[model samples]
Target chain A: MSISARNVFKGKVTELKEGPINAEVEITTSGGDKIVAMLTEGSVKSLGLGMGADAIAVVKTPWVTLLAGTPQYRFSARNMLHGTVSSFVKGAVNCQVNIMLPGGSPISAMVTNAAVADMNLTEGTPVVALFKASHVLVGVPV
Target chain B: MSISARNVFKGKVTELKEGPINAEVEITTSGGDKIVAMLTEGSVKSLGLGMGADAIAVVKTPWVTLLAGTPQYRFSARNMLHGTVSSFVKGAVNCQVNIMLPGGSPISAMVTNAAVADMNLTEGTPVVALFKASHVLVGVPV
Candidate 1:
């Protein structure tokens, strides 16, 4: 099947934490990077998620926000990654920023052009990429 | 290293079509779903990408747009997928909509609650998910 969803991660399930309403599942990629996904508890059980099972985690790019300079403020976001700016695609309204993570995997973020100036982003600038766990979607490979 | 890039697809490059400044790469996932990514020709050469090369494509979720009901409009977006609205999570400002594609993979989209209400989305609603090829970030497995 062809999918319009741009982000797709495949890994083995390492942990599954189920709650009354939501659940957090961690999948470790072959490269050893970990991805955490937050989805509905009903969906979690319905997918029969368990440790060692193969799974995929998907998150939209707009939900990802980049923090340049020092991320002086702290929030409850489950994923916070620090990396150097690898590339920049400045668009008319929204700017696409790519940060090269430690493992060589790059994370992309879409922000307004105004924010780009405010952050003074360019190649080699250090930034933190963050997104909420609830924005992640977990699906099993059939 | 730990990172926040939520979407990661491990696949082998099945086809490579190079253009003047940009290139389109086709990757086939383990489940046989093919994904197309558009990136700079510089990146293409730098990554030494060729047919049968292993690569990873990262796309921000926000790059994904969900269109409820039959999409009768024409757009330049390269990727358009049709799926059923498998799940919905209504939020204060935006709602997270998950569309289950034909191969049992679900894609997540973040849309304003106003848009959700405007579209009258419900379970089993058929919709088209669209995204641009330029919005995709292609990376080599590290």
Candidate 2:
């Protein structure tokens, strides 16, 4: 089914657990899907969501976006990667774009010299990084 | 530096996004690290986070856990997968594990039948999967 048709659940904030600012929200859908939403602590506060507050969540098919260059698969909007330019590693043909999120972790995305020059990206510049959620594979311990 | 010592930033949730029954929190740590936290929507509401509320986030080193009989690799706790018991393909004997994560997704370790049997895993029985944050390898798009 399309993602939009999936049930939307409203839950409450139970606990802000460990692991460097993580928020957990409990949601129960009409189909009895009891689920949780793991959010950055910052995201929780920004929404004014706190313990015992009601938050709405929906379960839909994965979101996907296609880019022109390569045949890379995209997931949904929920799984996109967004960050800011932290640093750049100069290379012979390409430059490594280091994007930092508000969480203090850094991600490096490679960009062509032409692209870099076109964007005029530098340290401290804000940029939106996008990727499909499916690109993010999930696994559990055996 | 430790993830705990990193400065945590908060952001406001402008919108309510939906995904599958099991939703993963896609977050950008303040230090520019893109990480996912696997949880249900119920978990998000329990934490009292919502649209426009402040969220505290931190960049942390990935969490890594080792499983027996497989190449040791890292797993990202944020990215959780759910699937049915497909079939016992190959690799180790005595284990009937299914690939719950999306097809073509990168996997650090494979689940075995012995492990499922030990867990009393059956077809259609929902399992609470677990992984570490450290296993997520971040790279720039080439």
Candidate 3:
């Protein structure tokens, strides 16, 4: 079978913080990049996930919002990956920007062509890729 | 400003098929992943995108569906990525499954915990992630 999502991180379950409605699970990749996900209490049990358990962090491409230059304000997003613009492409309505993290992981961001022009994003441009914890999905292998 | 989304792919506009109301835009990521998006003609014109334009493709996490094992019937979803269960975290209502494609990119799927149980997805389990092209939102940075 085939799927459409583009961003997938392989890591291990580092920690699990449970709440009434949601639970926080952190997965640290081999590269030491940490990804945080929010799940339901029932889900935490169903997956039977615990510390040092192998897991992966799933994120979709469109769900990633890109910010050019340094952020002037604090963001609610739990994950903010900083990188340099390695490359970009323009479509009819959107532009795909590739940011190479210091860890060598490539993060992708889809913005508007207008945004690209407005931000003056080019090669070597510093950018931040932001996403909320609620938007993150955690999975265990069967 | 920070927006909520997870998947962001940077690619080049390889094709643009225009329609009466909507247009088809194809973006080829640096990793050779071809992302297809359908946008209103007005959006196409507003982005001023043409051949060889750069763009990014965005997909939300909830929008992704994971299929375990082999598919018995064909699906209508245009994008299907195959990978092993890198890991997953279960939520109260949903479970997040991470599939690692042969391309080394990770695709995420959000399915119900019941579905994961029914499918028996586990580590190293082969799964397919699926999504519709219409679910894809094309954007340019502002």
> Which candidate has the top score in TM-score?
3
- How much lDDT does each candidate structure score? 0.69, 0.39, 0.72
lDDT for position A2 in model 1: 29
Clashes of 3: 56
lDDT of 3 by residue, A1-142 (tens): 3233345667788988987645788988888888887765556777787899887676665678888765688998988888799987566666667788777667676677898899899999888889987666665665
Model 2 residue runs over 4 Å out of place are A1-77, B1-142
DockQ of each: 0.04, 0.06, 0.06
Q: What level of docking quality does candidate 1 show?
A: incorrect
- Each prediction's interface RMSD? 12.2, 17.6, 13.0
Per-residue lDDT of B21-41 in model 1, one digit per residue for the tens?
667788766666566777789
Lowest summed lDDT window (length 10), candidate 1 chain B:
B69-78
TM-score of each candidate structure, all chains considered together: 0.52, 0.27, 0.53
Cα lDDT tens digits for candidate 2, A78-125: 334355777765645555566654554444554566767777777777
Predicted chain A of candidate 3: TM-score: 0.91
